[model samples]
Target: MPRFYIAQPLAIGQLVSLPEAVAHHIQVLRLAQGELVTLFNGEGGEYGATLSDIGKRHVSVEIKTHQPREVELPFGITLAQALPEASKMDWIIEKAIELGVSGVQPLAAQRCVVRLSAERAEKKMAHWQGIIASASEQSGRNRLAQLAPLQDYKQWITQQDMHRRIILTPRAEQSLADWARHQSPQAVTLVIGPEGGLSDAEENLAIQHGALPLAMGPRILRTETAGLSAVAVLSGLWGGM
Candidate 1:
């Protein structure tokens, strides 16, 4: 069954019209009336519906049943990544959602190559949010991931975080898998550096502000790979996988 993210309230027995983009998608896909589809509103669970009406530029569905099911991880994981070059951040956000991350935080670190001004950052934030919804639909997640506005690394580091912060770096003596194995499952905010990695000063500053440094492995992963890999490692060890 096809699944979609509806950014509104969904209830059983309610007849709902999809947005214009979704209507267009139904047209392009040639889905016929009476065909079943799944819809979620990010509040929780999912609704089962059938395409009740299909038009040239309109599509409506009658929600029939509700399934109180969720595939979220038991522990919340937040990816706090320094901006990378080009579209790597997009890839990271998509994969992070599929991997069951609860949130994404983009940071502008010292060695980051991609610099977004206030205007560009706003556009990027909106763009990344679309990725979150799309990824949620594809990954069978009824809830959407939280996307924090981009923050400066220095400023973001000084702020207090409720979840434990772990900075992934090559210099850390303990590997993430090792450290995670010995600990109970809990929420964690992962700090990943940019392409050139976090500067010595930035890493030291992170350590000063209660961020634990941990290594991925002997081989250094790229900016995009490190965070995803760390999430995978945590999922594997922490029983979320």
Candidate 2:
């Protein structure tokens, strides 16, 4: 069965017309009347429905049953990632959703290769939010992952409030595994730098602001790989994966 994110209040027996965007998708998918599909409203569950009606300009479904399913992680995790070049951020966001990350924060750091103007940033944000929804549906997540607005690296470090904040760096003596082993936190924030990684001064500033410096492993991972790797490691250790 295909799953569609409805983003509206759903109730059993109610006949809801699919939004124009989703209606077009149903048409493109060539779903016939009476076909089964799944609907979720990003309200902590999903609904079973059938294509009750299909017309040239409209598609409708009758909500049959509600499944209050949830697959969130044991602890909230946010990826404070410095903006990488090109479409790498898109891939990172998709994988982050699959790994059960609670949210993502795009950062503009000293070494960032891609800089976004306000107009372009808005468009990119909308684009990334679409990726988040699609990934959530494909990954069978009941809730959509939150996407925080783009922030400057220096400013963001000062505002983080998570119980645990781990900054990924190759120079750190403490490995990520070592950091995870010692503490139990309700939420964890993982900060990953851009392609060139964080500068020495930035690393020290983060540490001064309560961020723990942690190394990934012997080899240095790319900007995109480091955060996902850390999320998977912490998730597996803490029961999120």
lDDT of 2 by residue, 80-135 (tens): 99999999999999999989999999999999989999999999999999998998
Q: What TM-score would every model get versus the actual structure?
A: 0.99, 0.96
Candidate 1 lDDT over 16-98, as tens digits, reads: 99999888877887889999999999999999999999988789999999999999999999999999999989999999999
RMSD of each: 0.7, 1.2
**Full-model lDDT, candidate 2:** 0.91
Model 1 bad stretches (over 4 Å) = none
Number of the predicted model whose lDDT against the real structure is largest:
1
Candidate with best TM-score: 1
